[model samples]
Target chain A: MKTPTIRDVAQRAKVSLKTVSRVINNEPSVRANTRERVQRAIETLGYLPDLSARSLRSATSYALGVVYDNPNAYYVISVQNGVLSACREQGFGLQIHPCDSSSPRLAEELRDLVRRSRLAGLVVAPPMSERMELVRYLAANKIPFVRILSAAEDPADGYPCVYVDDRDAAYEITEHLIQLGHQRIGFLWGGVSHRSSPERFKGYESALKDYGIPLDKKLVIPGDYSFDDGFRGARRLFALRDRPTAIFGSNDEIAAGVLAAAKSCGIDVPYELSIAGFEDSPFSKQSWPALTTAKQNTEEIARHAALRLIAELRPPGDAIAAAYAKNEGFSPQLVIRDSTARARLPAAD
Target chain B: MKTPTIRDVAQRAKVSLKTVSRVINNEPSVRANTRERVQRAIETLGYLPDLSARSLRSATSYALGVVYDNPNAYYVISVQNGVLSACREQGFGLQIHPCDSSSPRLAEELRDLVRRSRLAGLVVAPPMSERMELVRYLAANKIPFVRILSAAEDPADGYPCVYVDDRDAAYEITEHLIQLGHQRIGFLWGGVSHRSSPERFKGYESALKDYGIPLDKKLVIPGDYSFDDGFRGARRLFALRDRPTAIFGSNDEIAAGVLAAAKSCGIDVPYELSIAGFEDSPFSKQSWPALTTAKQNTEEIARHAALRLIAELRPPGDAIAAAYAKNEGFSPQLVIRDSTARARLPAAD
Candidate 1:
């Protein structure tokens, strides 16, 4: 059987080629009665508009490219779902491209994707946010992109980004612990270079200062976001001469790892050592005692970012001012679970 | 600047468009000198074919569709890796489309994808596996697909498939525990309706018979391959007055849940009771006493299925047979980890 075409639709509808085009493009001048005929013809003929072929007819294709490198399944999946939902509503399709710096021809490869895909917009993820050369290349090429998490402190000057107040979430979490009388806290930070780490650390520091507790540098250790790193870093926390009574891990995987490490070492959780994590991932819930963490609302944030990208690419029929009026910057919510507990006071000698 | 075309290459090479195309397609009988000239012209013009656009012209698209229903991260990720690797090797782009029974207009939706995406082939995963109606629909439509674990008994009867020999693996594992001195054994079962479940149960039953241990109906409990099921099922095991010293869980998540359930109940693992699991997932290795489970080689199987799909889709010019010969079936390897232990003697009367 032959593939159905626009020609087939035109013939089946008993309409001229131009009339069929008008019906497909939803040109307002077409009579409602005639439009229904064309639609019926499309249904009967099972004629799917060759999306890419149709794009070739348009000056700009209705497609956006998403280039990501994040390893967190929940975060990535949420973002993909959000983007797909937005794309579906907008009559567009997303081209999801996952790349790692390990691709030998990384620069050339991304550039090739940009050119070949003929993408109207891009959704960039870390650590591509830190790839200045790639960013500059995209900018130079006049490509519009929305950065999910820019390593830059202030893309404020130029680049548009959907961001979280990581520092604020960290501060709130710390304060929550402080209220529970936890002073000797062990902070496990994500890599020192990422912008979120320093900001989160600052939040932890500020909470301690506000509570009039002297900050101890020895208690703060850098931890990569991996679960193994969590285990190793938590072990270091336990090795301290004045070991922390409470531990805060950078992410859920790390937090779970910390819990596992504590379990292996015979440390009672939320009793001898309270623990907490960030990014309320599936891992957080799956872990024993569950993790007290921050809810980033990743899906919602991703939807907002995708919507913003689509709006930037092709202005919707609605007014930009009205859309802006409805737009609100989001904040990460704190999810308190069983991981954290009241400070265990020293037993009487 | 400007986009380069095949016309630009022909113009640069001072040759006919046909001659340039012959070099591009690597057709036989192109003079070496002419081929070199064409290659040089192409390089100078920077003429990389726009695959989406070209597919419309030649009707040979570099796109494959991945259709699956399950939301399990481990399974999805493994399948994605396999499909993507195969697609990349064939210079194709992959579109991952997840579906379920509840998705309204299933046939129409799939047909719509087939029509719009210009897919060369497809990879389907369960519980979409059990949807024989959809399977027949796809076959009737003349679309090529590789079903992942669809047929338990006959793999090649309907279409090409990559199947796991879970029954055999389950048998050996159960037998291993028996050899370790366990008389009474517990079995945790997943959804019985699944095609794989009955086979796994058969292996367990037959293995026990060979070892002369009477099958204890009281010790077996129904579970799903999930954390909650494991937690609930293990509690039932704990409640039994004459509980088995060793328990076998259906999968890793259930195993983890069993471990968690034990920890919360103050029961020591492997010391007082032993537990085993199937599917050596990342969670298995990361679990407290890493799961002693069957290594499904999910990644390899996925790669194999994908390779098969691509081989089957190979064009007249391509060496389809050789490509298939390169990748045959891969068996699941048994990984003995920390989850299982020697069965302890029952408590003295």
Candidate 2:
């Protein structure tokens, strides 16, 4: 028989992890009927609330450390808001720390933060998620953690995670351009170390291959994730004798940067050149024509991940098992805006 | 003789309130030398190291509740960071609750947060700084607090505070603009009811007066501290038949927003218009031409505030008094960047 966790209980309860936490804390104002149903589910599932470690005595908390790098203001703000909401529901406080994802100091910082707080668990946001040392540190420390994917991890077992399906999203976006009758598409690659960069590239390639389009290696450009980098990357693409008809920048900042570069070079958006970006942020709306981008639901991801960590702090109840069995992966929703259109590919008949 | 509090001892010992707590409880790890110093300080100041109401504690810690409602990312981030840093150093936990600055729920939410966590203190940010009900409620309830200014207050018997000199900073900035040959300068205003808005406007007015320039009510525009407001404020100023030669925005977001609007209108920057902003934020650099603004040193302010709050938790000593007197007020540093230039009036001789 598969052992149950509190997360399973949350899933079965049809409530957020925070909601379950409130119930466990015996906090008031919960709808009486709903509480009764949750209680019934709990009794039926045979869930046992676990408190094996001194952590219970120290503090009965569902605390999780959220660490991030790649300081896109919108991304950080969204993630913070999501984590805050989840923490509120769980009766937990998130310990936020910003670290250089690639720095050797990362492991040290995580260790200090965890040891100092005696954390219940963790949630790692890229580019820290892709670093092996981070993964190894979390594993070695025996801390349950979920990593937001910059790339897809195999089998997703080390610690259960909620991830953005970047690959599919990227592929669909690229396909949208192709379907719009664009032949040559320019790719803006984020920093190579981020696993999502390659995954997104793969998605683009797969879509092209599926459509019987020959890949042009020259059109793929690499740059760090920033407005300046985006601007520069687009500039390189534009300077080419055979410029791509449309561009796919890594993220919104890069897309904006690309837009600025194009405008300065006498190119109009969506008319002379179409562009698309990832991670629909405030920047997307603020952009000149508004950006057509993928909405990653960073807040939802943070909330769910926090919910998972908090829920797992409880002992396995049968209801939790039932709940866990219901929801496994959450698919992202696409948001359409004005930044993209059918590419005006010269090759179009 | 004046009675002392544990904050006094902590300040004198150059340790945390938690450390003072440990010393009072005779918990381990305090050096013999430091312990003796604390003892001597306690004796000299006749301070009580213990709060009998709180000292008889249970398993849970005394949490600090923070209520805020400003969207200036840097400001929000800094405030949280400061509170977190203090909480960590004090060995106490903080629960953050976001409340509307203008909502009646502000007091209710704060009271609820306090009741739920059994909070020991609060750090109120702007918007709430001027809320009389909030101040009265906390006073009536005997909740200790520190208010980051939205307005100046009567200093006598006021709670220990950490505040920004908005009027002074604003005055200095406007004076700088004046020195660089600007008249008919624009003054962007912040939201109504925030005491700082009028205070900042006063500084701009005073600076113009000092230079013998007439206060043109036409140049003062009202908006919130938002990017969109910045854009609109600039538009309102530019739409005038005789637009100001230089613009001083309320905050960095507004400044950046206005900067963006200027670019959209195809106005030659610095050549045709001079722009200056307050709050030297990351957004300033992110702007196209960068921004010359005031560096309020959020980190230092937060660090000092946290340290001050902790300092107030221990028994007082002569050394502690010396330390407190040394750190009364911090001046905001004027961070001049790429955003401002000497103004050339519309019809210059």
Candidate 3:
């Protein structure tokens, strides 16, 4: 059987060969209805744009690369789903590359990935997105990319990024605890490498100041984002001479650990010590008390990042500008659940 | 910069062009050490095989498609990781296509995917793998594919499949519960469409027969493989006058639900009513009691399936035969955790 060609698609869609070419190239000039008609025609004819031919005409390929290094499977999966959704919408394929950010050969591996895959662009996920050197490398190479980041403000140099307002969300969660009559509130930190950790800490500190409560250095515990860290952090807080009435974990995984630690210590939740977490992940909802956390729409953030990257890869046009304009920062909302409540009196009595 | 050719790789690796071609094509004739050297040379030179040129030489393309329609994110992610690992090792790109099995256009959509992506083959995941009609369609089209399935036996026709012995695993889990002195155990099932559900049920029934315990219809509850279903199933069991001393969930998610339901009903886990779940998913460990369940090596199974598929795609040779010979079945191991315990006396007394 003879393979269908661009001309066949054009004939079926009642358009010129040039119009079909524009649609196939994802040019913004084509009207939405005409583009849909061409897409349907392409589907009906089983048309596959010859990648080699397309490469000869343009340097870009029809594939987008997603580079991430995250221990949280839930977060990684969510980001992939979002990126895949965007890729599918634009008739693009996704190449997921799970790499270790701390690896010595990180830059070399990324460069190799781009050259071999012939990727059109990339959607970078955290904490890889947080790496300045990697970002600089990609920028220096002029590779089209978008980053999913946790930052208080967008970079002044205008590198495309989808920012998450972790600091603001953390402050809101802390303020929620303060409003619950908790003066002595404990804070658990995630990994120092993650920008979200420091941003969230700043928010918590700001909330304490806003509520006229002195920031107790002893109440703050240093730990990573793992459940084990949350568990150990809570235990350390419990061992203190003046135990806190409320404990705020950096993320839901940490909060869930805190719940486990409390249970192990024979302490009742909410009634004795209220606890809250950041990132309304599965750990929050699956926990016994169902953690009160900030809902970070990670999937949505990733989706937008992918879309933004694709748009940037397209030729300069109104659509590309619109796509760039849509790259707005996100603020996670506070979700109150059973884990957090009014502070209780000391059980020492 | 000029593109590096296969000849360049040959020179760099200090091997003949034929050897480089053999390694690039993933032929079995290349020695392991020689193949490694060729791969390193390819990586060093940033070599990308021209897909168009390769397709002209052979019907195969350098891409593999993964088609799945699973609600369980963990399962899907694990399968992708496994498939991706194999693809990377073999220098093939992966195209993930999440589709509804019950869709009227399922076959058409699949055919379109193959034509457009120019996929050399596919890695099919359940419950799509359970659909015989889809399997027949792929076979009729002469598409190279491997299925990841949970079944009692391999099909007689011998289309490549990586089978999980769900029946054996389920029986082992049931036997563990029986030994724990829980004769009156409730059973919650997954979706009827899934072959694993019935296979697991059969194992449960077989265990009861082995122990000379009559299967109680009241104790068996129909449910999908979901947390909500587990919660509802447990509630129904609790509503019964002769409630079972223990409950067995079809999967970890369901068991986690049972844990939540038991807690809400003021029933202590393992003591008041022991609960056991199948598939040692993250849900099992994250749950408060840490579910007693069967550990399904899904990742390993998927990895094997991918390896098998890649082997099948290679030209007929000794290595290909060896790959086919390595298609061994898997039986999930029973893992005892905090959720299950000895049966207790009736609380009615």
Candidate 4:
């Protein structure tokens, strides 16, 4: 059997070849109903647009790139799925590039990736999104990109970005613990390279200050966002003469680690001790005592970023730009789970 | 700055344009040292082969597709990394297509995906790889694809495939439990759709037969490869009047579920009851009593599959085919952890 072509798709859809081409190109002139018909016909007939053949006559690319350097598999997968969803809907191919954000050649490598692949745009996720130099390079090079970042407000860095209010979400989680009468709440920080780390810490601090509880430096433990880090941090806190009654890990991975550490020390979760984590990743639910976490909806955030980048890539239009501007912010919500509970009296502790 | 061209790479590497083209095409005619020099020059000058431009004059595609339908995030990510590493090295772009294996339109969707993207070949992972119809379609259509599958021996499908010996690994795990004096051991199975499920079960049965342990239908539980299934399966096993002293889950996720169920039931792991899981996934390590599992290096398997596909895609040569044939088989090793221990005395039960 011969591979289906655009002409076959047009014939199947009962439309002219030019109309099918317009729909494939995403021309505004094509009506929505007709576009749907052509799409269905294309799917039914298994017709491919021959992007390489099309690119010969035009410079427009149908591929989108996702650039990130995070070690968390769950987070990366979620972001990739979100972006891929958007790309699929828009008939654009996704090019995933997992690169070292700290590498001196990052800018050059990214430039090479874009030029070689002819990417229509990029969806940048942290901590690559937080890199000022990379951001500047993309902007200076006129690369269409949307950044997924942790910020209280849009930085207006001359590029579209999706802002995640990590600080606010962290504050809510910390407040939940404080309200439960956890005065000596210990804090575990993620890697400093991630902008969310500082934002989350700020929220935890602000919550403590709001409750008139003086910050105790001894109760704070610094560690990267990992299970081992959480384990080590918890061990250090547990070793102190006056151990913290409650602990907050920067992410679900760390929080799960804390749970493991507590179990090893024979500390009953939410009874003798309380633990919470940020980013309601799979680890939170899989943990023995499901972690109380902030539901960041990373997938949705990534989807929005991809959509925003696609919108930016579209031909200059006021409606598209307005939609992108309005969808720039996202805030995670606190979700109470089994890992946290009311603090026990000092004597009981 | 103008995007670097193949001419620039050839000039920088002090090679003729024909030599550079041969190297880029992965022609066996190019010497190893010359290939390295051309690669370095390409990288140094950020020269993109302009796949679209090149394809206009030839039938070769610059993109490879990964077709899969797996719920395991870790598995998917590992496979993607493996394939992407191969793609990056060969200067090929990766196009990920996550599809439902059971969907009636799967074949059509995949055919469309290949045609639209002009994918050079596909690196297919199970359970999609297990579908005979899909495999037949790809072969009939002359679409190059390499399958990552679980089988005791090569299926001789005429298509290049990478096989993992799940049966032997499962037998080893069951034998490990048997050596620890476990008599009444329960078995948990993964979804029937997966070829590994039956292969693993066969191993377990063979091990039991070797030890003169009669097969007890009551001790076996059927389930999909998931945490919830593991939990439910363990619960069912524990409900039996004469409960098994040990349980073996088909995968780490299932084993982690078993651990969770055991914890909830207040059963002391490896003391009152022992548990083992297959696939040394992250869940195994993160589980409270880390699981004893089979270390099937999925990433390595995927990498080999990608390399095989790339080799097959190259201009036909005996050397490439021989390498592909030699690298087709893989065996997983058993890793014992905290989850398994000697069975307690019958009097204790």
State which candidate has the highest DockQ: 4
Best by lDDT: 4
Name every residue pair that clashes in candidate 4: none
Better of 2 and 4 by lDDT: 4
Off by over 4 Å in 3: A1-45, A50-57, A346-349, B1-58, B346-349
TM-score of each: 0.93, 0.74, 0.90, 0.92
How is the predicted docking of candidate 3 categorized under the CAPRI scheme?
acceptable
Go through the candidates in order and give each one's DockQ. Answer: 0.55, 0.10, 0.41, 0.64
- For model 3, residues A1-349, the per-residue Cα lDDT tens digits are 4568899999999999999999987888999999999999999888877654565356668888999987777888889889999888887878888888899788767876776667888899888888989888888777778989898878655688899999999999999999998888999999998889999999999999988999999999999998889889999999999889899999988888888789778778887889999888876876677899999998888888988898787767767557665557999999999988987654543
lDDT of 4: 0.88
- Model 3: how far residue B237 lies from native, Å: 1.5
lDDT of 4 by residue, B1-349 (tens): 7787888999999999989899877889888999999999987876767877786667788789998899888889999999988888777789888888999988878877888778899999999999999899888888889999999998886877999999999999999999999999999999999999999999999999999999999999999999899899999999999999899999988888888888889898988888999988877887677789999898888888988998888866766555664448889999999989999887876
Task: Report the Cα lDDT for residue B194, model 4.
Answer: 95
Tens digit of per-residue lDDT, candidate 2, span A27-82: 89789887876776666665544322224344444456788875665677667778
- Name the best candidate (by TM-score): 1
Candidate 1 regions with alpha-carbon error over 4 angstroms:
A102-105, A150-154, A316-328, B102-104, B150-154, B192-194, B315-317, B325-328
Off by over 4 Å in 4: A1-46, A318-321, B4-46
- Give candidate 3's whole-model lDDT: 0.85
The predicted structure with the larger lDDT, 3 or 4, is: 4
Candidate 1 residue pairs that clash: none
Supply the global lDDT for candidate 1.
Answer: 0.76
